[model samples]
Target: MSSKELTDKLVAAIKSGKYDAIICNYPNGDMVGHTGVYEAAVKACEAVDECIGRVVEAIKEVDGQLLITADHGNAEMMIDPETGGVHTAHTSLPVPLIYVGNKAISLKEGGKLSDLAPTMLALSDLDIPADMSGQVLYS
Candidate 1:
């Protein structure tokens, strides 16, 4: 589905006041990015940016928190510096881990995806399971 359709649905769902947590993925950034078309990838990124702005506004309106992150890095390294050609491979760069509306939270260095679960549970005032190996980033 297009990013617009997905974004619209996400906004609607957030405004409905029914869900405690929601996950929205915008695959265009990676999917179009992998095609090695620079212009199309730029447009795809712009669309995702607009969608994220909309979602952030919706979350703030409902006094809800937002945890924004990515599974991996794709568009960050678009072109080879030496070759000057389109590079189509995921990078080892660290993906962003943003926490909106949660001023008490602060991420330390060496954070991994496994830490997300514990951090999320802590943010919601829930207990982290003993078996979970991730450390909570915030109280």
Candidate 2:
């Protein structure tokens, strides 16, 4: 589905007030970036940006939190420095991990993906399992 459609569903779900946590992935950035079209990539980012605004509003309505993150920054660079063509592969760049909520959360800097689960559990007021591979992202 398009990012707009996906975000619409996400907003609806958030408004339902039936969930303690929600995870969303907008494939537009990575999937469309693979096409190696700069204009398409820009449009993809814009689409995701718009969707994110809607999501933030939904989260506000429900008094929930948002954690926006990604595994790779595929759309960050679209030009190949050597070949003069579009960069179509994922990069080694650090991905973003943004948190939004009313809670005064103090997130640790330089957190890795493994920190996500523990952070989520801590945010939910649940104990981080002893077997969890990472430490909670609170400083």
Candidate 3:
């Protein structure tokens, strides 16, 4: 779907009030960036930024929290100087994570991807599963 269509759908979903939280990973950045279309990849990133802005507004309307993160680096990044191209394989590079809302859900120092599940569960007053590798990040 076009970016406009996707954004519209996301806005509608947020306004529906059927869900308490939102989690999404738009594939445009990864897919377009992998194709080596630098211009298209940049456009995709811009689209995602606009869409996310709208989502955040909706979340604010409902007094909800948002945890935005990625599993690994794909877009919003550049080719490693050593590699000279987008790394065809995953690396240990740190990904970006943004927490928006109350201070209660803020991350403690040195949080990692593993901390996400536990933090979400804790925010909802749910017990963290024993098997989960993440620990609740206390701010």
Off by over 4 Å in 3: 83-91
Model 3 earns a TM-score of 0.82
- Candidate 2: residue 89 lDDT (0-100): 93
Off by over 4 Å in 2: none
**What Cα-based lDDT does every candidate model obtain?**
0.85, 0.87, 0.74
In terms of lDDT, the poorest run of 10 residues in model 1 is 102-111
Higher-ranked by lDDT: 1 or 2: 2
Tell me the lDDT of model 3 at 113.
Answer: 82
Q: After superposition, how far is residue 9 of candidate 3 from its true place, in Å?
A: 2.2
Q: Would you list the clashing residue pairs of candidate 2?
A: none
**18-121, model 3: which lDDT tens digit per residue?**
87666767777777756666677788889888888987887788777777776766655546668687643444567667777765554676678889989988
Clash pairs, candidate 1, are none
State every prediction's TM-score relative to the real structure: 0.91, 0.93, 0.82
Residue 47, candidate 2: C-alpha displacement in angstroms: 0.4
Selected candidate, larger lDDT, 1 vs 3: 1
Candidate 1 lDDT over 20-106, as tens digits, reads 888778998789778888888899999999999999999899989988888788887789778999888776788888888846666
Query: How high is the lDDT of residue 36 in model 3?
Result: 62
RMSD in Å for model 3: 2.3
